[model samples]
Target: MSKQISEITSHEIKVEGKSSVNQKSSVNNDLSVFADGWAIDTAVPLDLKKSADKDYHPVLKAFLAGSFSGTFSTILFQPLDLVKTRLQNPSHHVVAATVNRVQPGMITIFANIVRQEQIAGLWRGMVPSIARCVPGVGLYFSSLHWLKAKLGKTRNQDLGPLEAVMLGVVARTMSGVALIPITVIKTRYESGVYKYNSLGGALKAIYKAEGLRGLSCGLGPTLARDAPFSGLYLMFYTQAKQSVPKEWMQSPSAASVIHFSCGIMAGIAASLATNPADVLKTKMQLYPDKFPNAFSAALYVQQTYGFRGYFKGAVPRMLRRTLMAAMAWTVFEEITRSIGLK
Candidate 1:
């Protein structure tokens, strides 16, 4: 009887050991699957993991998409940009042919450029504009992507409106600082301040004339303008997208339309909020010697053009920014989606 009891106990111990080994093996297999980027989670489905999430070169893809979008939008809206720049330039006094002094409208400025500098002159700073925007937008998108990835903590990896604002502010601030030199060149090229025949010549001339400071003339105002603009735009855009019905987002065409509409609304709000900073940035970049800082530039605008001076190019700027941003984001989303990126 004692021997039978001993045999049963030994059998039980062997079974339990085998079960423990199987359990450890199962855990090891699960860990391996997770390391291979496939995880079994209760909240997020396995198939819902996008190709973009698995992509090794996400930042590079983002940059190319952003560059393509920026190029298309910048070229399409170059005329509006030129008009806005001309309107804001303190040097260009738009005196009417008649005896009365009046603030020139976009039509007046557009007509003047066509009449005096020819139709081609409407694209005055095309080279510099492309230079600044292509890479600038690329940098912005890539950095924005990186930030979202780093900061996102939700199961779906989504950002709230406030988080979106923070991401946009940080991303745009980095891009703005890195591209301010090109921005200054583009502004000068548009302002008709420098007479260089080529982009290279213009860059060389500016560097020689004012050194490094010349390249970064409007850094402060540029940051002030771009950071808040991007922050507010992203916040508004995110909220608008969330407000959209899930049914509407199912169709690609409907989604595109929704994105564009949301972008325009967001751009309008952000542009209005940041127009004063933009005006200051342009003024300081165009005449760095006269207005060395944002404060001085503010004073100059207030004294010269009064309360409305801060919004000198508001009309053309609003139009250009609204349309350009809408188009850029639309194109960017399409391209990224096509390339299997989210």
Candidate 2:
């Protein structure tokens, strides 16, 4: 009878063990449901949504952090770009006998512009530059972020370097198109070829004087300089992105660091690739009558100044771009994180 009692207790113990296993399974299922809900609330699937959250307030964020930022930075450092352009423009109308005593490189160019045009002269094309540049820049960033998310199916919402660059192109092209007219105007203004109180005035002046085509006067030179330059800039940026560890990419703050480096590398590369176009653009902007064809301006700069002159103002241009890029990227990240997107 005692043996029988012990055997019954053992069977009961086996039954209790099976019941515990079922209870454990139920807890796991409940945990999974909770986890899924949390993931959805946190926004795990959507990349653009994440980017928007990262942006904080969308257009306003972009305005302050992007276009406005870009424009302000451009203005702050523009004296350098201006002096560079002047030194590199390769003036053709040399007075027959003067021997061209000493061609101003950078310092003389700055002094002469201030002496001749005033402190404001250093920022000659600033209004037009910002006017055209802001809108284009706005389009470039917003569109790129949106389109890359939609097309790439980047489930993680964290873009790799290739993805970032492809998206960058989207924004760049749209911005490029929007800024075409403004670009022409900015070019002219920078070269001291024309002046207008507003972008409208410049457009009106161009239409009245040179016709619609004149508004797009140096399209070939603009495209020639910009397209390949764009490729080079993005490639370097992508490489930078790729080179960094994935862990760094996970940190939103790292975005700014990456962007700053990209801008510096891009500025250097762009200064070289597009120097020829820059020289041509400067010529057409200042003396369209003198250089009816973009090709002619290219030839003139090449023959007169040689290759070194082509890279004129590169130092300041790089400085401005690097600073702006670093600031913009850092600001964008801060804004995004402040909004709790991070």
- Scored by TM-score, the top model is 1
lDDT tens readout by residue for model 2, 141-197:
556545654775543455555655566555566667657778878766666545577
Off by over 4 Å in 1: 1-56, 90-93, 96-99, 153-156
Model 1 vs. true fold: TM: 0.82
Each prediction's TM-score versus the true structure: 0.82, 0.69
What does candidate 1's lDDT look like per residue over 1-342, in tens digits? 999999999999999999999999999988877877776562334564474457648788889899999998899899988999988973445665423767677788888889889989999999999999999999999898888778755324557888989999999999999888889888888877677687788778889989999989999999999999999998998899889887997889998999999999999999999999999999899888999999999998899889898888988899998888888899888888887766
* Candidate 2 local Cα displacement, residue 303, angstroms: 2.8
Least well predicted 10-residue stretch by lDDT in candidate 1: 90-99
- Cα lDDT over the full model 1: 0.87
lDDT of each: 0.87, 0.64
> What stretches of model 2 exceed 4 Å from their correct place?
1-65, 90-100, 153-170, 195-197, 246-258, 336-342
